[model samples]
Target: MLESWRWYGPYDNIALSEVRHTGASGIVTALHEVPYGDVWTRDAIADRRQEIERAGLKWVMVESLPIHERIKRDDGDLSQLFANYRQSMANLAEQGVNAICYNFMPLLDWTRTDLTAPTRYGGTCLRFEATRMAAFEIHMLEREEAAEDYPADVLEGAKAWFEASGEEERNTLLASIMSGLPGAFDRYDIAGLRKALALYDGIGREQLRVHYKRFLEEVVPAAEDLGVRLCVHPDDPPRDILGLPRIVSNADDIAWIMGAVDSRANGLTLCSGSLGANPANDVPAIARQFGDRIHFAHLRNVAKDADGSFEEAEHLDGDTDMVDLVRALLEEEARRKQEGRADSNIVFRPDHGHEMLMDAERQNPPGYPLIGRMKGLAELRGVIRALA
Candidate 1:
């Protein structure tokens, strides 16, 4: 894996100089300033590339050129939207950026109820509490029929939370879940969200899968033409939250996705933290099977609860078998080398990290504290070096 760190463009608190110090050679980023549905002009791509290169880092992956909600729903000016996407691909390729990571999650981009929850250590970590989430989904956003989706325990828990939560706490939780986290995507308003949902109305899981297939069918050819890999990130928590359908969760979903485009340009992001939130997903096995097609990787772990709630775990201590997982990925890399493939490097990032040490004082984004991820990257680097 070409070790990388996600940089949130020029506005990020963790600067490129800091990223260079993280011992990562590659930078995974996007033109977040370029608004939704707008084309990432070749000039913009080149400028970002130049900035990273000047700092002695390569722009290995376009963390995303976000596909607009309109495109996801197949609503409003799709011809123009897709044209923008294709143009963005060409622009990225022109600047030698290869891997492109995007997600098909609707309404929200990777929701988490708590960003600063206390961890087992004397620091803070990100967590997703199911009951608190249900409270927001049912009582706050009031997604129609949301209560029916939860069990009795979850529903009651949510109700209790909602009743106890102050107005400010409730509002913050809603914003966190609705707004795209700093590097992920932008936030959405309830009215705007309903409009996005209207596009997927009456569209069930199978239909959404078909829609994704149709999307890849269109996007992958362009990506292949441009020598770029379009890697889709899996649904966080690996389940349908907020009544939205999630197509990429498990192995079957991956198989279906790869079968759709049937090209190396179409690939997976393989986020361990996201997939490992589900106890049933065999993370190492999935990596081994899809390793050839994985262009981007997010390595983090989660300690899952019996009730389906979870907290982000330290990279090496979580339920995910980090050692086995790394060995498997290296094996896959070895296979790729044996085949003499000419692809861009596989990009990996420490997906989320605990807020530890001085980082505990810095008001960083949830799961993105610099010190914690630096520790994770250093640990993984040592493991990789020893194995090599």
Candidate 2:
């Protein structure tokens, strides 16, 4: 499953020569002008891998290098942000880039109230509407106990959807849950998300899983001495909003984060639309029980709703089973090529799509447009060519 495509660099407006005509060779990106705890040097990851090898493709996964809110709230000067995230994983393993994708969700990163919702094939997806995110946390980021996190008929249907909405639909649902979309590094406005939800006042969920196990005991041994891998990334509406603390949602929080870092460069980026927007997440049995620590993949599909809403559906039509999650990721890439594993080709992408045809007149980046992810990478390349 090495077909890839998340660009967002070189000022992405869908160009890397139009993502080399969407049959994707590989290019999930990052660098994003290096900011959050800085230092991604090795000449800026070889100048974005020579601009995705001058568009012939293949940058092969970074998708993120972010994790900073003082290393997700272990508070300021976290040893200089864990030594600039272990020198950005030794400057992305000095250039041959090894899968990285990251996320430890704190003050929102991967959320939506509706970036145009509609889809009975008239196309336009991205939703997530638990009472419109509890009417943007009880009347737009007011957030203090936020009506005891909903359920008096979801806080009276979020107070009649915030009094039948007005003020430009509550400022377009507070700029669709505080702006920043494509690979979202940061963005906030209702007084910077109410001072980032008062720095997670009394941080819950076992203190954010002990600050993500002290950020994987200081960046998983510098991503296992630079052979990289590091995946993480879940919790996009997996649970608990505004009150924070969503420690990598489910599959027993990824077996308590692969038993809190017993490495093989500690992995998992299996985002079947963020753990299938939680319908008791069983996306192909968590892709065959964590398919050998799954280093990268985000194949999309959502359609959930037993009250905790969801949307984005057409990567083989939601409630994920995209052909049994692509035949359990092609039987975990034939068990990592029968155990000879040198990361036996993983890279997936086609994560969020459905803004549809001419990407509904492109404004792009909101579940990333480009003809709805080239029709979800041509329906995941015809289900990985009829299941390989």
Top-TM-score structure, candidate number? 1
Per-residue C-alpha lDDT of model 2 across residues 1-388, encoded as one tens digit per residue: 7888898785567888888888788888897766777788898789889978987887998878878776677886588778878987887887888778888888667789878888886887779788878877877777767788777777888889898888898888888877534334566678877877787788889988998898898889878877888888888988887888787888998988998878878999988988888888888898798888988888988888777788888888778888888888888898889989877878888887888667767576788888888888898899889889
lDDT of 1 by residue, 93-159 (tens): 8889877999987656687888878987688888888899889878877788788777899989999
The regions of model 1 sitting more than 4 angstroms off are 181-199
Clashes of each: 1, 0
In model 1, pairs of residues that clash are 179-187
Q: Give the 10-residue window scoring lowest on summed lDDT in candidate 1.
A: 179-188
| Distance from true location, Cα of 211 in model 2, Å | 16
Q: The CA-based lDDT of model 1 is what?
A: 0.83
Error of 1 at 309 (Å): 0.6
